[model samples]
Target chain A: MSIKGTDYYTIDELMAVCMARTIKNGDTIFNGVAVPLPFTAIMLAFKTHAPESIFWSGLLAGLNPDPPFLPPTSGDSVMLHRANPILHLHQIFDLAMRGELDRIFFSGAQIDKYGNLNNTLIGTLDNIKIKLPGGAGSSHIGCFAKNYTIWSIRHDAKVSSKGQRVFTFVESVDFVTTVGRRTSTRNRDELGLMGGGPDCVVTNLCTFDFDPLTDVMRLKTLHPGVTVEEVLENTGFEPVLSDTIVETPPPTKEEIALIREIDPMNTRKVGFSRSALEKRYDF
Target chain B: MGIHSSKDKVCSLSKAVSRIEDGSIIAVGGNLSAREPMAIIREMIRQGKCNMHSIGGAHGVDIDLLCAGGVLRRVQNSYVGFEADFGLAPNYRRMVQQKKVIPKDTDCVAVLMQLRASVYGLPFMPMKLVTGTNILDLHPEYIVMTCPYTGEKLSLLPAVKPDWAIIHAHKSDPKGNIKLHPPYFADLLAIEASQNSIVSVEEIVSEEEMDKIGATVPYYEVTAVVELPFGAHPTSCYPDYTYDRKHLAEYVKLANRGEDVFRKEYLEKYVFGVKSHDEYLELVGGHDALEELTKWNQGTEKWCELLGRNL
Candidate 1:
């Protein structure tokens, strides 16, 4: 596989920029804890394309944080320093229920082929081997927010595999912590859920969108240097491939600089450092 | 009617927390890392309150320490862990994983709605947030109701009026009226939704000052009021001080290492060892940290300047 901008940018920066462009102007985004990538991406988008965007900072109940330095975690109290009209966590959730929020960032340890997320347990409820953190607000945010997006840092055979915990993209999720495209409108109506299911799934290697008809996750774009064959090999479940798969746009210098500005502490970039990447995949 | 004397409501932390009986549902106030009634929580542990049901809006050290101290039998809240780099709430995680305490998972909205239902004297609060989520199935208590007017279906969270509610605030009057600086998470609702409410504040002000600050929770609703400075220590008392990151990090590390170690050393050293909040404060770096933290309590102008918001 051939790649571009190796010297200029890292894969994580490219992914952040790619995700950042999806944020439309004036969109209100709700981000949860441990959200370095989405936090930086939203900040980058706000600084560039979407200046009017409001970040519902759940960490400190902050609104539109204009912090001097990005805190390491979304839960950091420093996020409240520059916030205006500081909000309550419930107030942020109230915005979601009121259809005021445009998008929410959600993730799970396991994602099924149909975009269903499982974060409750890796094994049976009675007996659990690996108990992932329960859905903090993703369960509601996934259905209330106009749309939600899921991103993954470790995209490997085990993470993207088809079995239980052994393979993440299972035939059926252990638990549907977050509603996704798999639940049709009729089903959602029965459950009294509004809003569309997950619209996008961004990862280190590729980006996926729901199929128009089937609502299954389909390949939308691949990061530079990655291939369809590699994605297939890594995924546990079969994914629909686009006929003309486009390369994910590399982060421009300006966007990169803005991301750096938002994250002067280098929290997001540190995860994508060469040594970190090498340790992750043993490359 | 005009405000009356609030002398009877004032009490010590021990007296405030004594209202909490064993096996009672106790609602706590605070966001993830802000305004948690740590002094009250510590007192509860000191008093040997065990097997109490814990419910709150967003809980962190308060609930985690209670779980670690073997005080909580079950925890019902949206989330219970320390956020971001602080990682999981160790004792909460260990207990839940070990099934020592039942974990009743709910969202932040659902928890508030439940409290709202109680506050409004309603059986349930209609919400759209929990719809189509696994919580409905996991907890069958959440019912789906149809809006009589619009005929639209919505999720109904049952009213959760806990037996006792404990909260921390910046200031309060003897009448139990509390004043919060800003980002008053769900403290008011929590206090209102409980059978009895105990409030710990940094200072006791005159009723005029309480009214000036807009005391949200009226005196009639308060069961007890205690003046305890730095009531929210490990977690923040927003506008007063940010969370003690190093202390919280140490807790997460010790709690994660093993429950035995947590129970033996961490618990012994920080909680059981120190007889009071002042002792705990002194042990954790004393008046120097408090003096430094006092700068944050003044106002947001300095906070904004530190953040470089103008630029």
Candidate 2:
């Protein structure tokens, strides 16, 4: 049962898409929090060291990525699992300011033509009215977590640029979370970004990976039945289309069970859409 | 440096806490009993570490010792409940009520901020959440004002970098290399946010042993590594294969009875009597004593479960 590409994807599928892109089995990659994606990336690794594992680092220095390994936000015993912590998150920042983080995924309040994020506030800094989730941690962390950037947009929200969303009566953040190549000003040496702004925008439609230059989110992969045109139509900004757009793999039974049964918090509240799946995806 | 695979480190009950310095920010790692370094934390209590800063996602025994010892200066935690309803964590709740330990009204942002700082190696992080929120203004300790280039007001919240992160884990190698299976305590951020770390382990193998298994946390970052068996006493996870039931019940008894009462009967026995986890076990006196203690702990846990609340 799917609407748009929703019927073809699951929350765990989104989780997996994000995790698979960022974490390697034993890489000591650092992670940030507020959601399970990064934590899942760590836990999913076969070579993770828990009860001592640090998050939000750039490299994967002997990190444990085991199945049963707990997510970082839990407690001490969960995080202490580690291997050779090549460097702490603080040290990793040296890489970040210098542009070293391999993959970054921070939620954005708005996204635009180019993938610049607006996680800080819903409205302008002055005469402020609506405030979405604060960007205290996400703001700086986003600067570092570069490779696999993402913004989890609800299927129902109507906003401006992913970078400039307007969620309230007043002008809130525009719709863009990760700007398309057409939007972002490119500058890595001076801490500027293009496609790195929002490499992937995860929504009900499907996953879109941004081009390094254009910042426009190219259609990386569609869910089992999602169409490129449908995704493009629903998208606020015109997304960059990858040379060979692919289809998202279907969810395995185990993935479904984990999404529904084990995680009660429903952190990723995505379910397959009935209509999206029932209809054709070749738009 | 390493653990003897066969021998459990000094099997016993711990009462007194030692080795904890005053005014240190200590991160307690465990949830209920699954993955906390309970024994070492108890040891810190026996050592009489005062004016302490304690942090945890969900703490059980460690909170008890810190509170009972009257050593808490500040507490940053999500929630604190003994095996049963320990009457709103007297040391914290009472202190908040009586203005002893000031509860810095904050939310989940600080937790993420600390991890972010540690992750990035920044001294303090400039965040966007606490700004314009009560948390920034409410806790004088966390607030700072900044003037943006555009002639606007911005508040800067100093980051939380703990002095030491004390945690107990399932396995580790000689060089303090650790292995966490799953459902671990919140070690990622706790370790990330702290300046230093100490690990008390259930079992320690050789470095080769750790290597054989695979990657583990390097020992260089860990200042102290001890092989303390039953390390997480009063905690329900490893060693003895069961939770300390009666001990938990005792905590609840003291909790329900009130802080003063908790001090007299329960804290006196557990918090004051023994210094080491071993001593606490010895004072447990025998198999029957141990069994009885666990029974009560389990009962208290059930009672708390039945009541179904932290407050």
Candidate 3:
């Protein structure tokens, strides 16, 4: 719960910083609807490390919008405040098809070891227990974008309404809303997916990267104060772990300040649960 | 589909919507919350339009309200929720869960490709993505095949020709020359691909004025035009007004309370109770509240305040 000798920050801030760090300068990045965390991270990257990166607003279809403040909704007109050369929906898709899209960020209800995502449903298709808002473009973006990052605010296992233990990180997602490195039968290469699948997964508990050889998720770094045992216990499937499991780097003072500036109203925190919002870090 | 070349295509809101029969596939324009043809949608509900198949890219209250009103039998949409403002759409989720409505959930690109097939007058369109995902399984209309030219696997999406495409725009001529501002999210596609297109505009201008503004959707493509100011209310119509967040919040709250409460309180009070769009506007808050939404043009502070952001 506490990390000694570190600057004060919230878990949301830390996760945002970690995700922002993945964006390289000049990379064309896009985030899906309702993704406040990635939105904050992209803006943070613009203000800090990757100012040259292109921010293609998903729902708004704006390119590199300079909004006064982070709006609660992604498709709000505020996103198009100073956005120039606004693109049509087809144009954005054309970019993805032409292999011009560099990066994309998305999240799902369930993620398997291979990084396949399921935002469609929980139980079987016929006997549906829970129906999620359908994946808008995650299926296409996951397959087309040069690389994508899967992020989540929830990391732990919880009991479903049906009294079944539900793990966010599952062995196999109930439905594949977005394909990752490998499916039940074939790998990404064999499946002819243009994108490199998910490069990394940033979560409240830890960060994971797919193993190059096996195409399975591997523990890359643990969030500060998150124990390795805690992550292993929470994950539904066993993930490959490095011999030296390092702590995820906390956001620098400047990065935290930039995040605060970009999201003055703490719009980034809107996606987090009330209890998760209360989880604060201190030196 | 024949071109609608009539000089004056303007008609009453009810008349415009009446062209769309029950069990018709309707493609509602707008992405998520902005620029949704809410007034027309309200009219459809009031007229008791039912068993309609709905299609869109991203949507919130508009489609959710349609589900709430028992207006749809199937939804071929990419998303249907209130982004981060609220969480999942209550009525939509409830209906889909109970199997009252079929969830033919689609990807945005997939919808675009399918609609493009219709626009291009093709039987089906070949797509590279979505081959590995389970969305193909959900959409049996999508056929997986090896490309003859490249020998690459591709998913062929059947043309999705909606019966009507409903849109709300900034301005229009009497002949239905629609002009919209930036962030035209697939509205043009929806209009072009559908068998018939209906548009409601905030203002009705002359042909000269429309020419000066540059029509986004020409009169030939449009079947009917209705001059319904603030037609995209509750959602947004851009420069004219922003989304009524407080009103939408109230809607979400009522919708979340379940079917009975939503039907009685939200639907009855706002939708069924109002005789017309003006009545609905008056019920929401009248001129004073609408003026407040237009304050986004004043400055960033006012804009932030409008969005309920405290900085």
Candidate 4:
């Protein structure tokens, strides 16, 4: 359980630390609903290096809330505790539309190599297989926020009843709920998207950044025990590998303490599976 | 639009909901699990309103109950499932998978833009985003046109003038003037944009008290108001009460059991089984349950406990 260091941490903690590292010191960050990982990461960033960063609690519509504890649902009014200058839903979207938002985080059911997200449904409109919660503001935020990051708790592929490998990272998403780096044939610039598509995708297993030239997902870092081979096996399409893939930096003791303090109920573990939750790492 | 200057617009929940007809496009206020018009939604189900089109921002049990009750023909909201608290809304997912309710999935900005267009008395509003996403494909009604001022292509979202805007608030007057707490979500916009609006509040204060509170929704926009305390039960009405997590947990459990069981166990037991909101309240542990939800104001520890979070 030890990875090159003495401090023990879980995958969720590492994910939160990695995500927090992406945030800038004064970025006006926002996160969508049901995202405890990002919510924790944002709070971690605020408490640590990004103290000046403006944290807008999505759905709750609170600004820089000093919540006592992380609620299970992001929409919980507890997020408004000590929050200043509460903004309405329209005002939040208006800020994004006016291109004032600095950074936002989103999670999806399906993500393609090009970073297109699908939270709408699994199948076509006519014949649906599974109906997921529709994308709340992903489509607009992905297009308007200055920058956005995609995070997910699920990274591994599943074996369907028919024995097909069902990949969370697919070659093409069934529906594009959020436009990422590019579509199948056109780039975001050509399509007149306002914001930078997707900066990076942080998952349970590894971290990915878009290839600068092609906009395809590129493997940037792997978690403590994950390997390139495992990522390739789980992904439906091949990802551009960096010249040097490094291990994701383990969560510092301070970061771990802050995360625990923010989420004492361990609400962040709700997104992980039972086995994944049991995984531990010695930093 | 005609002005609603009536001195007294107060009515019973049943009488207010009777104005909503089948196949009407409805805009529901409140975001996610907070401040939703739950009592009004229950009344609508009791009245057997069907084939309605629902539009909103983020939502959970409010729309799910409608779908479970077989009340919607089209769902145009941005998001619906119970966020992290539970998971995918069982009844809504089943209904969409079965093609019983057509999913007209929309984005939050697009919805706001369309509603703004309606409020501005315009035919459509143009936007630069949502062009490359499948939302444009899902909504064929959006028109992609080349902007005359600049050569950039823009998507024009048509105005969404709903037949009714249903909302729940903390306080209102008999004349229908209302006051809402912070984080208003799209309630005010929805009220002004819709052709008509009906509100349910925790208390009906005097017109003088409404003036002192400063009305968020003016009397001219609201068609009717009902004093239905705990109207947003199962959903939080901050400063009044938090979401009924234990009750919502039971609802999610029953909803996951399948549509037939939900209809019988949940719909028949809590919704249809009760003749009025008072009866429904009595069934749900009466005053004790409601008092516990309001205990968030007691302290941070009690608030965390209300949210099922232990310090």
Candidate 5:
């Protein structure tokens, strides 16, 4: 499944890049509460390339649920496997530490250059308005996986434009799912690229990845029918752009089929972006 | 008393299966695949266990074998596997295709909520989660339940209260007070929902040690606890044992491939020949009698293989 040209990508398409580019076959991936990264990894692992990827989720089973892949949390029942989870959620730390995992799909309310993720405490701890989902297992596993793929659908002017994200009510969250940098911590070597941090951000409009050196997360590509300027206008953070910036690849018929056709339990609805999101394509 | 004699032990897995009559609600613990007591589950299928309503936990070999073999008539909660290789359980898909098993879909909280309510003795748990989305809406039976107190628009979710609760344990006393660390709560709740609970334990402690142990333990909750060493080898219970990957990988291949292999390999290899839990342990080891797992490898190697492929 290959995307073709210079265009903005859909959330699903960008999610594919997050799955494929960040993770390869057999990589043990840790998924946060609600992420498409592990979903993409598992689907691609099953259908296309990686046939033996290790998946970890919040669900106690640590196995992927059957079909059409609608994961509510990284550990939703969908990820459980009656036959094999290698280990369940209880064994996540053991496996990750042993270098058994290669990738992780996480959500960070705030992220920095070093790939440190903050999924909780957006504002001050004492007086909190919007209390996001408490960190299920994101804190420890986020830095442990080989590739950390971060995603959030609500990247618009309100959350993104500010130095600190304000929730539906937050003053500022200090971390994010993936920022473009590496940390000095020697504990996490499984994650490839030393730090291809945040590998990709799957938004309503496009998919994003950052430069290896500059530590700047730039708009990697736009979804079909979306312009570079359109992505920037909607983007909350200043992104690194190349003059010949490529357009986001289009979703393949097969990729489309994998998503549209055998969607697990018909859970894959046309997921909506944030209220602030302005996508170029209807999908 | 000795922790485990390794002799005169009854076949706990088979014993557990014997209690589960057809169509009875069975609550099986172990997350997704890990910590699941496959030995007992396989015995049920090999014995041609059928028409049973399987409840609780995530997808793992037990659900796979049952669904693939047509033993399961209905499936509640999540399963098949989280993702990656073999994506989902083939047998479950086939069951869905043949329209044999009913799929009860739910979110993590929903599944937890259902189980949580079941154990709590609440008639039903109220959820703010919008039901119009996905599998949550698929099974109105599981998603909605009437609040016994309110008598209002409470969605009636079935009490996961099972007829028998079968679980794999690391260590427990003969009296059935168990000690487990992180993964303890899920199993503890399972016991609360079921009428009678069976525990296949790794070590059966004396009253002294068992009394000294303090964890999630309720004497009233347990019915039977068998001391079966290496019982949860491949599946961890923490502070007690680590995952045995090789054994689990073998199960995964069979489960993903469907029931034929499961019947041949797992049922034949582990279940049929063993007369009891001690007999099964003897099957893994020999006359020397006792065997201890030092480190698990099959899983790490396979994980390496998976990591390489993902990279």
Candidate 6:
């Protein structure tokens, strides 16, 4: 295992900077509500590397808003002022339906080896189970965005449960809230979906990408102080490993400054669950 | 002359809600908490309108408040939650999970297309992206048909014409011409698709001001206009004010405790207990807070500097 300045950065900052780098300049992104991490990362991208990136909030359709602080929800109207090229939810969908969206961000309570997401429910529809906030636009965004990013803050037994975790990553999710690339290319063609499926999965501990051939999730990079053994132990399924495993780069001075500038109040700092933040202290 | 017969076009919030029958299917404007017609929603709850249907791609606080008051028999929306970071909407989740309200889990595109079909005066619209998903299974009402031209499989969503569309605006004239700050998320669509539409505005300006602002909704499409300043209340009206996060957080807190607690604390204190939007506004804060809010909305007061420090 390799290490980078161990105590200088938090896992939340690492995840934000790593995810920020994935966003390219001029890329149009559809950011869903209830996603504080990705929303902050997108703002970091805009501030640092991807200044030209257009952020489309599904709630307000405010494109490229200079949000004063990290909003409680993506639907918060505080981001409305100074927004250019404002849109309706339907217009955002119109872009997706027409295959115009370049990237979309989604978060799920559960993700699978194939990157299939579930934010709908934990068990059978009739008898009952833990009911999650229904997939708002994740399904359509999955089918429409050229590529999508799925993330979660919790990466322990609760999120990556061995067998009892029906809501977390599994062999098969209870409901397909967001389709992964595992669906045959021919099937997507038949369904008229243009999306290529999820590009990567960013968790609190590490980053995972899809295998080129099978679309199965493969370990891409481990965060500082995290070992491959730990990732394998935490994940539900056997994730394929990268050819040469590397440490995910910690937040650069510039990234830290920019991320902090975007979130001056440390709203993002408290985004992690108390237990998850406590676990990171060992790192 | 106005676009419609201006025979009593302007009315009180209570009067506007009085027109919405108990079993009516209503399309609500505003996205999430922004531009939500909170005053009208409170009025509806106060009036005890029951068994109503709500339409939207994803409903926010307004619909959630209505659902909390047991005003909905069924909701035909794509999703209902406070968004990712805000967690689940307490009342809506409780109602659906407890089998108190039937949820028609449709897709945002499907809902929009259904409204679009009505706007276009079409019987139904063909969609290519709706195949191969559980949405069809969830919403069996949508008809799947073969495309006539390409011989390809397509989904046909029938027109959804709501009986009344309730919307809020930053400003409007006496004639009901509306001007939003921007991000017209489904508000214009709702106004056009409904058989009748009522508008609640933060302020009423002159017709000339509406013309200069380039009003999005025509007076012809509107059924009535209600002047209710700070109409969105806890939600934002854009250039008027931002959402009162503290107030909403309190609502979420009380609502999450349980249905009984929410009904007692929130419903009793906020909705039914208040006589009018003015009373609700005063009870929530008052003229002093509103003055501070005015400064905040105009960008003169930096929320990031003031609230950011404590947050």
Best by the DockQ measure: 4
**Segments in model 4 whose C-alpha atoms lie over 4 Å from true places:** A1-7, B309-311
- Angstrom error of the Cα, residue A29, model 6: value is 1.8
Better candidate by DockQ, 5 or 6: 6
The residue ranges of model 2 lying beyond 4 angstroms of the native Cα positions read A1-283, B1-19, B56-61, B82-87, B141-155, B236-250, B282-311
lDDT of 2 by residue, A52-165 (tens): 433442122223433222321222222333434333333554444444555545544465534455432333333233323233233344434445555554433355556563
Q: Which model scores highest in TM-score? A: 4
**Tens-digit lDDT string for candidate 5 (A1-283):** 3433324434544455445555676766655444444465456555666666655545444444443344322333334434253343435544654445676665555544333455333443333332233333343344334456655544444545557534321122342322234443321223232223355555545666666555456667665666877766655455677555676655555554454333333232224343322443332
- Retained true contacts (fraction), each candidate: 0.46, 0.02, 0.77, 0.77, 0.01, 0.52
User: In model 4, which residue pairs have backbone atoms overlapping below 3 Å?
Assistant: A5-A283, A7-A283
lDDT by residue (B1-311, candidate 4, tens digit) is 23688878899899999999899999998877889999999999999999999987888999999999888989999999898778999999999999999999998888999999999999999987556788877888998899899887777899999889999998888888899897788888899899889999999999889888898878889899999999999898988898888888889998999988998899999999999999999999999888888989898788878888432
Model 5 interface Cα RMSD in Å = 15.8
Weakest ten-residue segment in model 5 chain A by summed lDDT: A168-177
Q: How far in Å is the alpha carbon of A239 misplaced in model 3?
A: 1.6
**Predicted candidate 1 versus true structure: per-residue lDDT over B1-311, tens digit per residue:** 11324566889877778878999888888766677888898889888999888776556788889998889998877677665456567788778889888877766667778888888889888887455556666679887777899898777788988888888888888777777776666776777788888889899998888777787668877788899888888777756776666677778888888988998878889879997788988988888876555565444444433322221
Cα deviation of B35, candidate 1, in Å: 2.3
lDDT of 5: 0.52
- B262 Cα displacement, candidate 1 (Å): 0.8
Model 5, C-alpha of A112: deviation from truth (Å): 30
The ten-residue window of minimal lDDT in model 5 chain B covers B302-311
The residue pairs in collision within model 3 are B32-B58
**Per-model lDDT:** 0.74, 0.49, 0.86, 0.87, 0.52, 0.76
Report the lDDT tens digits of candidate 4 across residue range A1-283. Answer: 1223436788888889989988999998877678888888999999889999988888767899988788877788888888888987777788887788888888789999989999999989788999998999898788888888888887889999999888889999999999989999999888888888788999999999989999999999999889899989988899999998999877787788788888877778886888887887875
Candidate 6 interface RMSD to the true structure: 2.6
TM-score of 5: 0.52
Output the lDDT of residue A140, model 2: 40
